[model samples]
Target: MTRSTPHVVGRLSFDPYEGPAGGWGSLSGMAKVVLRSGDLPVDQLMRQNKPGGFMCVSCAWAKPAEPHPAEFCENGAKATIWDLTPRRAGPDFFASHTLTELRTWTDYELEQAGRLTDPLRYDAASDRYVPCDWAEAFAAIGGRLREIDPRAAVFYASGRASLETSYAYALMARMYGSQNLPDSSNMCHESTSVGLTQSIGAPVGTVTLDDFAKTDFLFFFGQNVGSNSPRMLHDLQKAVRRGAQIVTFNPLKERGLEAFTNPQSPFQMLSPATTEISAQYHQVKTGGDLAAITGLCKWLIEADEMARAAGNPALIDHAFIADYTEGYAAFADFCRGADWGEIERESGLSVAAIAQAAAAYARSTAAIGVYGMGLTQQRFGVSNVNMVCNLMMLRGNVGREGAGLCPVRGHSNVQGQRTVGITEKPELAPLDVLKDQYGFEPPRYEGMTTVDVCERVLERQVRAFIGLGGNFLRAAPDSPRLEAAWGSIDLTVQIATKLNRGHLFTGRAAYLLPTLSRIERDVQDGRPQTVSMEDSTSCIHASDGTREPASPNLRSEMAIVAGIAQALLPPNPRLDWGAWRDDYGKVRDAIAQTYPDKFADFNARFRQPGGFHRGNPARERDFSGMEGGRARFILPPGLSAVGFDDAPDVFRLMTLRSNDQFNTTVYGYHDRFRGIQGTRDVLLICAADMDRLGLEAGQVVALETVSDDGIDRRKDGLRVTPFDIPPGCLGAYYPECNVLAPVGHHAQDAKTPAVKGIPVRVRP
Candidate 1:
């Protein structure tokens, strides 16, 4: 454990990959999974992203019409193999490893143990989980739930659940008098939903997949496109081949944005050719996106004024703005007065780069602004999203073909969950529809979000915690506090597909309920079934699987949710739990009943090829939802979204996903795209910062948080590694670096934790 060594940081294997992403690297990643998956279900792999197949559980990227023969990406294949692995972590496996010992394992090692095969209940006497019958587990859980105040319980759902299952979960929570219905969006894209609703009068993106083919210019901010959504590479390639311009502004120079070679292409597999994705890549500082985007707005507005002064055709779309927008005068004034020196200093970019991006946008007839969590996870995440909207509305980029704001979501059905009423606010919940369909008034009290739930649990205000999916404990920003808060709860139930560290944090009464994954056949009522999911573009698709379930004891997420609802609520004709579980069609019918406008022909439309568009009115230029029937040009709160202007020698740290992992699940130890392998506990810092601190690559160091929130946080023994990140910033894999993002350090107005730009100082 000397300073020269990696400390607890596992062996660091570096391979600086030179070739473009998605060629040999993506193929090799998929091949390794296939070789390891004994008796692989090749049919599932072949049918993924196609009609009559399951949507990818990895991301929410839209599935195109007439998809390629192999529609799945490298990470999607790995997730499939991981879900369908022959290995099992059943009762016997749990009996051997005590909960205390299992806590010491890495996130990768814990999940790599394989899928769960049986229901497990924590044994307090033995300090280990033991096998339990579903009846007993459900009964005990139901009994404890019945004793507690329903309002004190939190029903958390994951993006992996189908829209049908999410609908059921939402209805069940309301039936039981709890509105604390928080899902994955609370942590990732809640800002996108909130900010867009305030700006464009809609909560979803206005851009459709067809928009990519027609856009003349695209502005990509903060998102690492290739690693998060490989399928999006297809759209980028088509846009480039159509002579469209793409500009990228991110702290790190992501390989996916640099160049891409489609793995499915026969020519790409044999040669070294690549399609360049970004025409101009600007390395903005972490939390600098607001300033950078505002700079664009300033340049565009000035250029427009100059064109008008010269008596030429106006650069701005005055007709569109007059007819379709509000607050133009005020928004224009703010941008006109913005100082270029401050923008340049804050954005870590030269005036020339900002001017270059502005010139490109000015040359295009249509443009789109695309972003990811890198923008939404900042301290001012809501404002970050509003700024992007402001930039779009300045030139009438929204509400036209190939022109709009695109928020690249991480989870597959996260947006769908929100569409179906998985919300904490009483105003956002479908209370009236539930009252109409079920003949009872639902609760109207405001409920808790992810952060609020964690705070309540820490205060012992929560009596029960139930998760439909996701690693709730590991995903929390302040790990030590939430881990203890989770243990303080009276009952904790996790309906999951695999083993993970979250399962090890046994509460007073805990149960690990194994459920079916998307890759499995969810036959119900003696008939094959299909569930639906909503992609990022508001398109709904039906997903069906042909492979067998991982274990006979496992049930579908819908079945498990229905069983719990039945066990807890009194019998009622309007709410027939058995019918909902017996046939997913009944669930869709109920959803349609709840939201006739969006799900009018739910089951029918979802069965069609490439499914149906749920219809975003924003795309058709409908702004009646906003005041004065027009989109609003929002003013940003300030120049810097991340407010640590005076913190000296502190690196702005953001959590990242390696090419080998998903949300909180690690598939391997390598991040081939970034050229780092064999470890997750390493901190990526720039060489100048290393020199400034008198440190070198491979030196084990500590990162202590610079916060006034009175939470003493530090991640020790992280091996320092030189990277191409902006000078005063650092990057590390998520969940591994989640401890640095304090719970209270979140986006204003939205509760998404500020994991993208945490202020910390490195110490050796």
Candidate 2:
């Protein structure tokens, strides 16, 4: 229906953007999305993130209590317009293009083809997808699902699904007697959850949006605020204007963390002036956040002894450590005993750089630590979180008025889905309440994670896959392997808003069901339905649509989940699938019953303008939920930043999202911030590394993953570009470069694919 931004081989532009993160640059990008999509998004854009309006369906960044008139960002606009486009892939479109021909298209091309208008089933003889009646499609899928062992089925959830839909989906999975409910979290913040839970007895972050007001010092690690969450630039600008300190640690010196020009401000937009963001920026090596943080802890502990002996103010919170934490002795001893040489080497920073940050931490009255996927998608991702927790707790940041740890989550409502029982771990869910309410025993056994699903698919153990959302094959590691394994499944169902490459990776019996986006009105039984979302800050708010559906035949996610469940399972009086699908209040009521403490009066609380915070115990310094009833100081695993082989010839390649991309969804071909265009297949390597590898700039190069595992993961035709990254580090766009990250070589504890620090060798 429409052409996407073409991906073609071209000379790369490395002109550094001179302006701030958001200005006319961002506005122009948003305007382009509107013009190209043949859709007018101004009305919907005005309502996004407003009071009683639909939440932005892009990032999970929290909405402020007093939001700006335009609370959405450039990427948010792109996501909305990307969904609201007039292009439709109806029966005619499918008839014109065979499945084999569709498979040859790029991810951008496939998405640009348009949104699916009706339920479709894969036909073997025709080698294409044909429109089918909703009932017939559901019955066929249900019959196939019933034939398979439920345990062999994987129920995947994406972050775009509202809490109500995720709740119903979770119930369906449990009713089907399976707990393989792995969502997008497994690829990104799973390490945050696992590490935070082990250290502080809570899986969620402790910091709230208001903490920015009182925080004088902010420590940002592995997160590009400008690109990842541009709305965060507003808070950074506020903090800067108030003379607060923002110190950033990242491999790349992102423009957003450095400076910002708020698009909402007419004066700034008209002028050349921009607000400076970070007071100090440290370019740490890829996978070196652990060592960098450990160095901070080491410096503080070493300075504490000096201060105490000199009768100066103590550097660390000694009283808090003694009274509210355990294992401080072992943790402190380990840090003090750490070698300065190793810390400097592993962190890719000198002792002076580490000491400067430690000094700022020591002097700060209150501070906050913000991180993202960069810290979590590592070999020792859990350890990375524990170290961040250790650094924050050393200053008593946890439970403080203006200080805590904030993991900036990606994708809207990812955190909310986990809260509402879309999880592989049964212990995390209120299984007893689910049993009492639903009249079924919730699956107790631990289910397969994302990595486990990919691995099992090869062995044919996972026979069926029902994805609520997300491009699993593309987002996952070992793309070629997963894409090949995709067809081996017996049944695969995707409830999506638009076309993605994931739809083409069909199984023997596959169905693509178009669903209403969160921004579209869902009328059930003549009643306009509403749903809820939980932001990264744990603020639960209602998100309902005023815009009509893209297609008349499109169904709501809850309805699709219910349809499948009704066809597969026997009738049960306790579970009211029909009401939950239509009313949505019934779903929220059920969620409230499951987590009464958190979701009490779920329907009422979420109606508030800013919504209600789902209280976190860790913020209150309540460690009773953890072992030994106290926050524990976790010891560092090793002196090395990456807890893997340190081969000299191997380069550390970190997968990244382009400025115009989100996760696996490539919106365009250009990463404007990095000065690249018309392609996503460029490798960013430092000058020193380029010299060592004897590679010329703009030369197409290939990369082979260096792993002990027998599986050889490789990618070719990447144009090498010299960059300002750490000497041994390189950067490449994800999903395109996701091929180099082999399965099973992931964060074993969190099961997150180590996309950030993949060891690779480059060849021309």
Local distance difference test, each candidate: 0.87, 0.87
Candidate 1 at residue 368, lDDT?
A: 93
What tens digits encode model 1's per-residue C-alpha lDDT throughout 1-764? 11233424345686677777798889798776666656466788888988978898888999987899899888888888888898888888998999988987888778878889898899988989999998888788888999989899999998999999999999888888889999889999988989999999898899888888899899999898878888899989989999999999999989999999998889977887899999999999999998898899889889988999999877788888899988889988998888999998889998899999988988998999999999999999999999999888877889888899899989889999999999999988768878988987798998998889878887889888899999988898888777776777899999999888788886799999999988788888899888999999889999987788878999899989988988888898887899889999988988888888889978778877777888887888899978889988889988887867735588899999998888998877778888887777788988888888899878788888898878888887688889999888999878877778888888889989889999998887
What's the TM for model 1? Answer: 0.98
The stretch of ten residues in a row with the least summed lDDT in candidate 1 is: 1-10
Task: Write candidate 2's Cα lDDT for 1-764 as tens digits.
Answer: 11122248345465666667889889877776677688877899988888778998899898877889899988988988998889998999999998889888888888888888989999989989999999998899889989999899999999999998898898899999999999999989999999999999989999888898889999999998877888888888998899889989999988898888889998998888899999889999998887788889999998999999999989899888987899999999999888889888888999999999889888998999899889899888888889999999998999988899999999899999999999999889889988888788888999999999999997878899999989998898888887887888999998888888788888889999999988899899999988889999999988879888889999998899999999999999988778778888888888888898999998878888778998999899889987789998998688544556667788888988888877777777667788787788788999998888788987888888888878877787787788889998999888888888888778758989989988899876
Which RMSD does model 2 reach against the true structure? 2.2
Question: Residue 234 in model 1: shift from native, Å?
Answer: 0.8
Q: Candidate 2: worst 10 consecutive residues by lDDT? A: 1-10
Task: List ranges where model 2 is wrong by over 4 Å.
Answer: 1-12
Candidate 1 wrongly placed segments (more than 4 Å)? 1-11, 35-39
Q: For each predicted model, how many residue pairs clash, with residues at least 3 apart or on different chains?
A: 0, 0
